[model samples]
Target: MNAYLTLGSVALFLALVAAVAVALWYRRRNDRRTHSLHQLLELADCLEGDLKTCRAGLQQAHAVMSLNPDLPAASEQEARHAIEAGLRSLLQQRIWIRDQAPRASQDQLDRAVSNMIETRSRLGPLLKALDQAQHALDDAMREHIIQRGPEA
Candidate 1:
């Protein structure tokens, strides 16, 4: 009876130890996975913020151009150049994001890049028009000032 009891006690102790070790291992693995997922989410958030800022800048430039109607020839040229530069930068940024982003995010980045590229292509004429409008307005204001004489 004593021998049987001692053997059963030893078996029970070993079983408990194995169960504890397995639980610890599983918990550690779960924590690592949770941490990795959080990091990915944070990265995604940052990328989205960058995209929003870029979009806002582009929109503001568009709005400014829209408000002006008879800008000078030189001003039109400058605006076109600026627009081209912005478009090129956007294209490069899109390419970088698409390449560096994780597979899960690549599609979203790619679509955004495509849209931006298309918009950029379309902006050339609009930018020229805006420049022309702004320059014309400036020239007219200058002429009015000159005609009015220096000061009262």
Candidate 2:
């Protein structure tokens, strides 16, 4: 009788240990997934700031182009439209990310984040074009000022 009771107690203790270990594993997994979601949200915010900066640069280029008609008209127009389209797309992406992050599965979050990053790469060309347009506009304005003297 005593041996049987001892065996049953040991079995119950082992079961409790296993249950605790499994619980801990699940908790850690949930934590990791939550961390990934937070990271995605942070990246989305940073990208939005970058897009805004690019938009501002494009606006500046447009203003400069307006003030100096001799600047590359075609390039300025292209840059403006490209930046506008980029902003629209970025906004849409941010909306999707925000809407989906909270209740998303780990695999889905991973794919969404990776895809967002890939799409962001496309914005690089648009930003580069904006920079080039700005430089050309600045050069034209400088030349005009120099030709007209300090007082114009």
Candidate 3:
């Protein structure tokens, strides 16, 4: 009877250890998933901010371009279209994150985050160029007005 009791106690102890191990594994898995989600959310936020900035810059460019009808608008229009497309893509990404992030694997989330980072990096130079163009346009307009004088 004593041997049986000892055997049962050993089995109970093993079961408890197994339970703890499983719990730890689950906890770690959840933590990893949460971390990935947070990274994705943060990237999305940054991308949104960058897109907004680009949109505003485009608006300023448009306003500047409006003053001079001789200026070619095709490029500006193309930039506007690109910005709109980026916004749409960002929205889709947000929706995906909302609906599928929980089920998404770590590799998938990492790849998404990497892609966004690459996009944002590419936008940086484009934004810089946009700003320069706007400034140049403003400068040219100023020069034109200055050359024409107030009495004209």
- Clashes in each model (backbone N, CA, C under 3 Å)? 11, 0, 0
- Candidate 3 lDDT tens digits, 8-122: 9999999999999999999998898898899889999999999999899888878777877877774777878988999999999999999998898888988888898899899
What is candidate 2's lDDT per residue for 1-152, written digit by digit as tens? 99999999999999999999999999998997887777777767767777787878867867776776665555666756866776787678667777866777889888877876776677668778768867877887888999989985
Candidate 3, position 35, lDDT: 84
Off by over 4 Å in 2: 75-81, 124-136
Per-residue lDDT value at 137 in model 2: 75
Tally clashing residue pairs in candidate 1.
Answer: 11
How do the residues 1-152 of candidate 1 rate in per-residue lDDT, one tens digit apiece?
A: 99999999999999999999999999996665555444444544444444454445545444554454443223444644664666566557545555654443434544554554455446545556655655665566677668768992
TM-score of each: 0.39, 0.76, 0.77
Taking all chains together, the TM-score of candidate 1 against the true structure is 0.39
Model 3 misses residue 110 by how many Å? 0.9
Per-candidate local distance difference test: 0.56, 0.77, 0.88
Worst 10 residues of 2 by lDDT: 68-77
Of candidates 3 and 2, the better by lDDT:
3
